[model samples]
Target chain A: MPKSINPAIRDFLDGRIWLRLHTPFTIEDINQQIEAGHIEIIQGIESKLVFMNRKSYTCNRCENTDQSKFTIFNCAKCEASCAYCRNCIKMGRVASCTELIVWKGEQPIYPTSHTLAWEGTLTPRQQQASDDLTRSQEINRSHLIYAVCGSGKTEILFPPIFHLLKQGKRVCIAAPRVDVILELEPRLRVAFPQTEIESLYGGAKPTMKASQLVLATTHQLYRFQHAFDAIFVDEADAFPYKADETLQKAVRKAVKPTKPIHFVTATPSDKLLVEAKSTGGISIINRRYHGHDLPTPAYISLWKYEHHIQKGRLPKKLTDWTNERIKKSEPFLIFFHHIGFMEKAEPLFQLIHPGIHSVHAAHPDRKTYVQALRDKAIPGLLTTTILERGITIQNVQVAVIGAEQRIFDKAALIQIGGRVGRSSAFPTGDFTLFHNGITYAMDEAKSEILKLNKGGGTNPDELPFM
Target chain B: MNCLLCEQPKQSSPSWQSLIAIEKSTLICEDCSNQFKRVDIIEVGDNIDSITSIFTYNEAMRNYLHQYKFLQDIALAGVFSNELKQALSKKKAIIVPIPMHPTKKIERTFAQVDELLKAADVSFEDLLIKTNQEVMGEKTREERLSMSRLFQIKPQVEIESTTYILVDDIYTTGTTMQHAALTLKEAGAKTVHAVTLIRAASEQ
Candidate 1:
């Protein structure tokens, strides 16, 4: 092994963390690096026998220890019954015989001379939260920014991120949903114009550049290992991340062991709130940056709205609401709990205004449809909870079709209502919850908004802002 | 029981046929099996006498192969094991699985053709060895047609004066089968027949 490392190998692997053995790089180059002690290989899956000689396999990358998600097959390569992790198989198959390579070469030197090109000024509340975040990073402490939706959460991250980058520290902002990452990429790129930013998601093109800042979905973090100095999880309580423990483990695995994971979200769960309070690292901003009250959802009863929609009829109250938004040429978003119901109601909504479209998680045109609404090229969209967060459409009226459904929990309903009145240009809009019957979740969501509007959750030190 | 392909529980309903015949555990559900379009098409090649395919290379079959082979989900090989068993049971010929290159076999972890035959509980012999590691899937039809000898009989294998059946996962241009059939025929086999899980629809 030579003391001098190959530059090509270093460039390909610098901050990539861990990559599968079968990568884009040539085998000869990788072999040379391995011989030079500039690269180390880790077994993709490790196995050990448990009780009664039942073998248990754990994915080295995702740390998935669940026995059900592991499957064994007679492997010709290893000549044994090798186990692979099904949980993270979509990234690539990580079997017991497979190898993952990480760079042990000299680290790339990052430029400390960088600029924060954000031209906008933060409000007093935002500045205080931003200072709190920056100070926490200076002391190497975890912090939570409990800001309301549309409270300029992304802007609050800029100063702290720039401060870290000034010290040649790598940072990653991971979100649970791809939508949040997609929304944050362009904004972060604009804020730090000189820095190399890599945005990684499921289908994103692989990049070999050594980036100082990374914006990726939490699912994408499974490929990264001890890569970031500071990792901030945006929308930390969102779906899959909140419910799936593996994603939380991925976030913890992605950052350096000595560093901390900061969480930024509008609606913090009681568990998150209590943890942050014990550490004295929580900052709450009750008001939106536009200085407008959060839109409290107004409930309207539409008994058997499903039957009318299935029977090719629109309920009267819903029709009137759509007609008003159509007449005023205001864009609207009607959330549905189920994709099937939203699809059935699509044509009826389109009949009222032919340009209305429906979108869901798997919709091919979901990205384009959201773009169309932002461009004002369409009337509105009927979507599932996928659009509950990480979207801002000015003057767009919002409604939820099945508010009583179990899918619309307190956090979900709050995020949905936060979609309204986002832009300062039109800081107030109608937020209606059309339901067959009002449930406890709906009432709780409405009252939570009222409480936040009355400055109930603001930081105690900043009570004067109320 | 769960479907081998989709991993969903099989919907079982007792019928008159269930009472009379021994119950065989359903390996695939109706929904997953229904997606595959079966085409019992047979094509006669110059060297290989005939190539019989059980299914067409439709979108569903493509995804099935991707999961079974590329993604290395070995349980999916049993998805069509029953059909393969029924088809191969009556044949009087010796079964030979198309061999993969040793390196490629090591990389893929399992021989897909051998696994397909093993899942059906049909015994097979590896009579031929792949000479080259070039993936036929990456090459065009013209390139494949022009490609040279890819298979050769194993050194110690004896080719008897009896019928031989060649089994492969897919029949693309009939090039690999033709090469293997030519190898076996040159080794003194009486006749060669091919069976593939899927026959790729001819490119226009």
Candidate 2:
């Protein structure tokens, strides 16, 4: 057999991500592609819960193998006991016999002509971090960007990204939260208008074009293998990413073995910081791109806030706090620990203004509601920790209703406080914690903000609008 | 022999009306009808005229339909069809089984919703066709709404003054049913109601 250069086969198989064989094509065509070395069979994982009789089945997609968790049924079609993994059944039902297919051919050779389109100048901190990142990218060495909140972390990413894209290498910016990816999508599109860029989350329509740049949630990385020349993980220490081992494995699997992976976040875990520092110099920037101090939360005692919500009334202090913002036509996010209490308090808060709405993890209008807040279409939103991070609203004041709840840990409180004063228009705003009593977590969050403010290394005396 | 699904002994016979409709051999004798949980609480909305489900889609129903639809077990459809048939005692309306897109039809040998209607001997016209082959089973409620352009009316359906009961296998979020109802009403349906074998719990 002779090797052939087939462009159609190359286009079909060259995507860095996994492509299931769902296209309208014949088996003979697939065989031809396979013979031409453009496609190969990738075996699915075997059952991790095989019994002694080898009659057990498990799902390899979500790594679910629990006997009780397995959805067992006797299939009359296959005439055998068939089991499906219900955990990831939404993607598609994966049975014991399901075959996972992947492309195994030469990838596309992109031209080194991609240009950065952003005209804004970077801050000194951003420039230094960008240079450090470029050096790391040059050697394909792992790096981290330990920048404070509102420290122009995304801008710091631009120069290094432009260099990598110009060199004709595929790169992905993966975040743990969907909101982060949503926020980055438009910014990245504007920054690299000429290059093909695809954004992949759970419901995002997968793009047909082979993108040189990709913005995706970490969960979407499971479908990729040796895809990116370099991968940047935003919100490196956020939940579901920090707790789930599979997500960490997914990021590792997404990038080629020889490629560099970088972490960028304001609240880096000690372990992450230590790891980054061990490998050469870790680029840490403590100052916001705007020369302003981090917002230190003001602790307010709203004794029995939950109790007041239960009585179908908002605490006078909380109500007054909300009314002030509403009267001034200011947009804000009031964080709650529980959805039930947040919903119960929503109508009472709505009494101040009908536009006030609440959202939780399962709210169907979460995206719309958040967008409205950004567009300032709504007065304010009652929310849970889902909006604690990756949400940027100009001049928005942050308030946590139940600051004493165990759910509002040190990291969560900081992230929620970080939501305030993020935009260039509003470099300083109030971050208030309304609680019956201040917990250690709240204290620690305040301390962390103050520490970052002191160590920001900027001319603190030159801070504006203080 | 015990019931194939519950494996419980023949506890109670099915109602006489349902018994007369099906052969004795196919009778799920473990009081399956006793297990027929009805969600009579109907919420009326703009696009969705009304929703009526015969069986409260519980755990067993999920497993049963999972096998019937995904596993392609032809036998389970008969069980569901029989269970739903005797209980469908409502206004006489033309049945319309939610359709699979042409691409999906080519992928799967048989249509899950169509097979149930066929097994039940229900008179249904293929008046609607799914335009997008995208699966809604795994999508979030927001995704389902955004992707609500999943269906289109078949060009040939002369729907001037006909009643339609949109037939589907399961009703969870009611997104698909609402889309179908909206499409039917837009095509000049006088009345559009939805019927599903089981009603899954509203996660909300």
Top candidate by TM-score: 1
What does fnat come to for each candidate?
A: 0.69, 0.00
Instruction: For candidate 1, give the docking quality class from DockQ.
Output: medium
What pairs collide in candidate 1? none
DockQ of each: 0.60, 0.05
For candidate 2, write residues A77-123 as lDDT tens digits: 34555565544444555554455555676667876898799989998
**Among all candidates shown, the one with the greatest lDDT:** 1
User: How well is each residue in B87-116 modelled by candidate 2, as lDDT tens digits?
Assistant: 454568888888988766644446788878
Q: How would you encode candidate 1's per-residue C-alpha lDDT over A1-466 as one tens digit per residue? A: 4567877667657655555566777887788888888888999898888999988888988999978778788898999888888778778788888888888778888889899999999999999999998888877788999999999999999999999999999999999988888888888888999998999998898667778899999998888888889999998889889988899999988898889899999888778887877787878889998899998899999999989999999999999999999899999999998887898999888889889999998789999999999899998999999999988898989999979999999899999988889989899999999999999888878877888899887754442322
| Lowest lDDT 10-residue stretch of candidate 1 chain A | A457-466
Q: Candidate 2, residue A291: CA error in Å?
A: 1.1
| Native-structure RMSD, model 1 | 3.9
